[model samples]
Target: MHRLLVVLCISVALVAGAEQDVLELTDDNFNSVLKQHETTLVMFYAPWCGHCKRLKPEYAKAAELVKGDDPPIALAKVDCTEAGKETCGKFSVSGYPTLKIFRGDSVSQDYSGPREANGIVKYMRAQVGPASRNIKSIDEINKFLDTKDTTIFGFFEDPDVALAKLFVKFADKNREKYRFGHSNDPDVLAKYGETEKIVLFRAPHLANKFEETNVQFEGSSESELSTFVKENFHGLVGHRTQDTIRDFKNPLIVAYYSVDYVKNPKGTNYWRNRVLKVAKEFTNKATFAISAKDDFQHELNEYGYDFVGDKPVILARDEKNLKYALKEEFSVENLRDFVEKLLDGELEPYVKSEPIPENNNAPVKVAVAKNFDEVVINNNKDTLVEFYAPWCGHCKKLAPVFDEVAEKLENEEVDLVKMDATANDVPPEFNVRGFPTLFWLPKNQKDKPVAYNEGREVDDFIKYIAKHATNELNGFDRSGKSKKTEL
Candidate 1:
């Protein structure tokens, strides 16, 4: 019976491993297969990793699509623990499921593109051809210009010159972000300029009353082209979506609203026009953009706000990445005032807090956003506060031990406090890098909070308090013990 059961388990494992759509490679065939294909995307993963498990089905779906393409973009995987450990180490892969694109003669680049099936398929298709497409005539130039994304065209009479080579190199690095094409036709080159000129044409839907529709560049380096494209890609009030948020440079002011281009285009522009009015006044002071409220709801929730009616939400960030919120209702006047104050460094940032507890004098005092100043910052007694995330496993283990210490020192001269770091905003002076971060706020020097890195036992807390407390304790000794009152 034992032999029969072992045989059944082995059979099931073999069946599951054979069903993978992606080709499995080891050190022996890895380089051979990479050299065989024009473009191959490889995922280096381990079987026991949770993230790799979740990505298994998504990768399988993408592999099926890429294998059917004209040039056949090979989707392959290397099991680092099974038979490919040496291959993973050679590539310096330190994480599970690291993706890299291998083009035959070119240097391999990391694949930071999307993870979903359709998005990966689209991204890989873009990599199948040359970095920039070759436009043979005026007809092909007009066809290539018809795209939803901003397009760049380099008109050169000769394709083997230095400028053409530089343009292709830049496009090779940024082709995932924008469209690039080059034309050598005399008819097409005559329209722009006979000289070699790079022209950036803005998207039609991105047109506005502010900023030019197109711009020509005479720069010599790739960095200058990057700067020119970034500065001129979007109009005055940039049409920002979730995918393009990282492109907008700070200090940035973003307007979040119910913007639907297909369902209600007029309403989207109505608010965009209002934001443009304020954007023009602060020109060059900061970058301005608008994002869809529903799409941006998760991030706004971190700022402690919910989706209220159609009234738009306004938020700004400084160069330091400190966030500022607008409290008043959305209006041209209110928005303009908020921008002026934010740029002038006068607006108070929004503080996120839960409702203060009705009675916080328990053994372990609770510190919240509303009472942080009263309980931890401005209090006269020494405070040992724990900033913790509720979902953290380490914090859950320390909860009962912390309660015991607080009860043991109920009559002492210090306060034992805990705050939910997720639900409340911490001050800038204290940095909480991980869960269950503890800090000691000594008396009179309330501004300076010393970080606590001692043990987590009841004795550890008591001893730390005894040595760091500003006022001597009445009920405890230096060794963290109860004082004797025998006479």
Candidate 2:
């Protein structure tokens, strides 16, 4: 009797743990199963793919939640490595874990959405019918807002307007995360205080109990309008678009790269695996973003960078009107250092373009990007270098003052130099993200270069140089007075 009870308990536990909500389909039964269910979400997956393995549990959980729906949405999976090769090939399943929805044995749509259980369930629910609803009356507006956490409503004079069509397209893509409605009624338009053709309505929820607020769409382009909606709706680390740039209030760090999932799966993981790690660490301090190189070509041109040449360029922008580009190769360590400097207010602002300064035959020597190491690193003398841009008004003011200070220290063993940072690259240690950045390199090769942030006056420069010079100055004391000091 005891042995039989134990056996019965083990059998019940095994049956309970078994996944019954999801159907396991093969090439033989794939067509037959689709015929039975009105709506079916099919996942074509390979056994060896790591991403597919990670997605399995989440997909199972979503299937269990969606099993009890009114229409009973069916969840099914096909192992392409085994018996579903023909079926997978039919749907062009190049990547592992490809999800596609079949409706009424004819209509089908690809699912490119969040992979979490809740996200999958919500997305499949939206696929049951048209993602966005058409609002016919003012009473419908009130009822819709009451149910949804956030809803974007488009109100136009006619249903055939270009904006309405654009709104529908966007709605279909993001229906899982947001509720969308459209109306051509004049009373509904007057009730929502909408003068434009489209507006986003933020409904009152537990987090925000305030009344609904309307966000008007002011841009003419579809990409611009779509970007605005995404930025307002999504969390941190969203896709960077032209419209989103204007709404960036906090410091932003952007990674521009091309991700090819088919050719290199590891490269596609670079954004989530590598970049997101840095973003998570500094979630409060900055907003991290990834933008496709092709989509943001014009924006990249404004920063004086060729997005095509350098794949995966990292850049930083702050509210203080400073823009900085990473000088070193892309790595976790390099990115962390770049962000740390930005937070510490150590980086210099980047400029678009600047002409090379003419050799004015002054005491200050000129350094270029190619010869930076030859001039500053190889030299034994203590060096004071000014990294400047030609277009900077502040740099223009400091040029004469720098020349006078260089003239005063010509007789000393110290070397004074200036370089056009826009035209030339400097070492990563220079941290030149702004105009007229100054650094003091000590004579001893062991010592690192120190930024000179004191006033740029002739006296200030002389005092700093004298203090850091290797040999004792004959005319200046420790306090920069005219008292002679011994070596």
- Which predicted model would earn the best TM-score? 1
Clashing pairs in 1: none
Question: Taking the tens digit of each residue's C-alpha lDDT, what string does model 2 give over 147-176?
Answer: 424567788776666777788888887777
Candidate 1 C-alpha lDDT tens digits along 1-487: 9999999999767546533658788988888777878888899999999988877777877887666676578788999997999999989999998999989623378998877665577678778787677788878877777655678878888878888878888889987777788888788888767757788888666666866767887788989988988887776788777557788988899888888766887888888988988998988899999888887887688787776478778887877666898889999999999998988899877777888999887999998887988988877788899999999999999999999988987887788899999998887778899999999888788778899999999888888788777766777777777689879
The lDDT of model 1 is: 0.82
- Please report how far candidate 1 places residue 124 from its true position, in Å: 3.3
What's each prediction's TM-score? 0.69, 0.42
The reply for model 2, stretches above 4 Å from the true place, is: 1-19, 46-49, 64-73, 80-95, 104-111, 118-128, 137-143, 146-149, 160-179, 184-197, 203-213, 219-224, 234-487
